[model samples]
Target: MEYVTLGKTGLKISRMGFGGIPIQRIDADGTKKLMKMLVEKGLNYIDTARGYTVSESFIGEGIEGMRDRFVLATKSMSRTKEAMAKDIDISLENLRTDYIDLYQVHNPNMEQLLTVIGEGGALEALKEAKEAGKIGHIGITVHSLEVFEKALEMDWVETIMFPYNIVERQGEELIHKCSEKNIGFIDMKPLAGGAIEDGRLALRFVCANPDVTVVIPGMYDVSEIEKNMEAVEDVSELTAEELEAMEKVRKQLGTNFCRRCNYCQPCTVGINISGCFLFQGYLDRYGLEDWAKDRYGAMAVKAGACVECGACETRCPYNLPIRQMLKKCAEEFGA
Candidate 1:
C-alpha cells in the first residue's frame, strides 16, 4: 500500500483509507472481521462520523485491541460550544479511544462557520479539546471551494476533507490550495458514491492527483477492500483520452451524479435521499441491476417521497433537480 503524509499532521496515511460509513450496515461480527482484514492488509487510516448512525460504534468494536495499529478520525456536526463538547465526548465513547488522530467539523457551510467560530463559540471548544489532548488535530469537511478556501486561511486547521471524483473536478483548485498550506486533503466520494462504474479507473483518477493525501472509499466487503487496495499496486496515470472518457460519462449522467454531500438532508419526509441515488447509480454504472432494484425497493420512501417541493434543489450545492431525478428513479427502479 502506498502511504502519503497527511499534511502537517506529520502522520502517513494509506492512499486508500477505510471509510467507516458502510460499516453501519454490517453487523458487529461482520464489522470486526472486515476491520481486521483491512488492518492485516496494511490499511491504517480509518475515518468515521457521528452522523453515520452506528459507524463509530462499529469501528470502536472492530478495532478495540488494535487501536494503535491505525490512525482514527471522526467528525461532529454540532455548532454550539456545548453541543460540540458533548458530541466530542460521545464520539470518544463510541470510538472507545482516549485521543482521536484527527477530529473535524462535519460539512460546515459558511453560516455554520460564522456561528461556530465568529463569536466565542465552537472553535474555542475545539481548541480546548485539543489542549485537553482529546484530539490530535483540528480539521473541517465541506462541499464548496468557498468554505475550503476559508478553512485554509485559518492556522488552527491541520486537515481538510471534501468531495473529489473523476466526475466532479470542482475541488481541484481547493486541493492545490490545501497542498500549498500543508493541510491534509482527504478525498471523500472518490467514486462519486458508486456513481462511477469503473471503480479501478475512478480510484486511479483520484489517486493520480498529487494534492490528495488520502482517498476514503466506503467498503463493506473484503473483496471490495481488496479491489480498492489493488488499485494502489499499479497506479494508472490517466491519459488525455481517458480524461475525455471520464468527462463524457459525467456529461451523459448529468444531474444523476450523487456526490453524497448530504446537503439535501432531513428530507422533511424522512427519505434516505443519498442512498436512493447511490443504489440507482450502482445499477447504471456497475450493472448491478438486480441488487440495485432490491435495495431501492427496501427504502422507506423509495423514490416517491420526493414531494417536488424544490427544497432539496434549493439547498443542494451541486444544483441537482432531486425531485425530478427521484421521480425518474422511481419509474425505473422502484418496485
Candidate 2:
C-alpha cells in the first residue's frame, strides 16, 4: 500500500484507510479478524467515531495486541468543553489506549461551529487533551459546504473529512485548498453511502483526485478490504470504459440523493429514513426489487408512516426534501 504523511499531523498513513462505521454490524471477534487482515494488507489508518455505537470498544478489542500498527482516529458529536473532555476520556478507555492519534469535532452546523470554538467550548477541551498527551491532533468533519469552507480558515484544524465521490463533487475546489494549505483531506462517502452500485468505480473515482490525502470506505469483511485495496492500488489512468461508467452513475444519482449520514434521525413517526432511501435505490437502480421489497417490508415502520413533519428536513445538513422523497418511496413500495 502506498503511504503518505497526513497533512500537518506529520503522521504517515496508507492512502486507503479503514472506516469503522460498518463495524457496528459485526462483533468484536469479527472486528479483530478484520484488523488482522488490515495489517496483512498493509493498511495502517483506521477511522471510527464515538457516535458509532460500540465502534470504539470493538476496535479496542480488535487491535488489542497490534495497536501500534495503525494510526487511530475517531470523532464525537459533543460540542461543549465538558462533553468533549468527557468523551475524550471515554474514547481513550474504550479504545484501550492512552492516546488517540486524531480526535475530531464531528459534523456541526455553522451555529454549532461557533459554539464549539467559543469560550468554554469543545475546542478548549481538545486543546487541553492535546496538551495532556491524550490526543495527538485535532480535526473537524463536516457535511455542509459552509462548514467545510469555514474549517479551512481555522489554524487548529489539522485535518478535514468531507464527502467527495463521483456523485458528490461539491467540495472539489475546497479540497484543492486543503492540499494548498497543508491540511490533510480525508475523503468520506466514497461510494455515496452505497448509492453508487459500482464499488470499484466509486473507489477509482475518489482515488483519482490528487488532493485527497486518504480515502476511508467503510468495510466489515475481508472481501471488501481486498476489493477496495485493488482499486486504491491501481495507479493506471482511468480507462474510457470507467469514465463512461462514472458518467452513467452521475446521471442516475444526482446531488439531491441522500448520503445516508443519518443526521435526519428520530423521524416524528419513528420511520427509518435512510433505510427507505437505501432500499429505494436498490429497487430503482440495482435491479434488486425482490430483495429491496423484502427488506422494506420487514421494517416495522414504513415510509408511508411519515406524518408530513418537516423535523427531519430541518436537521438534514443537505436540506433534502425528505418528506417528498419519503412520499415517493411510499408510492414506490405501495405502503
Best by TM-score: 2
Estimate the lDDT of model 1. 0.85
- Report the C-alpha lDDT of model 2 over 284-315, residue by residue, as the tens digit: 98899999999999999999989997999999
Q: Predict model 2's lDDT versus the native.
A: 0.95
Compute each candidate's TM-score over C-alphas.
0.89, 0.98
Give RMSD to native, each candidate: 2.7, 0.9
The 10 consecutive residues of candidate 2 with the worst lDDT sum are 254-263
Error in Å for residue 32 of model 2: 0.5
Query: Which regions of candidate 2 are displaced past 4 Å?
Result: none
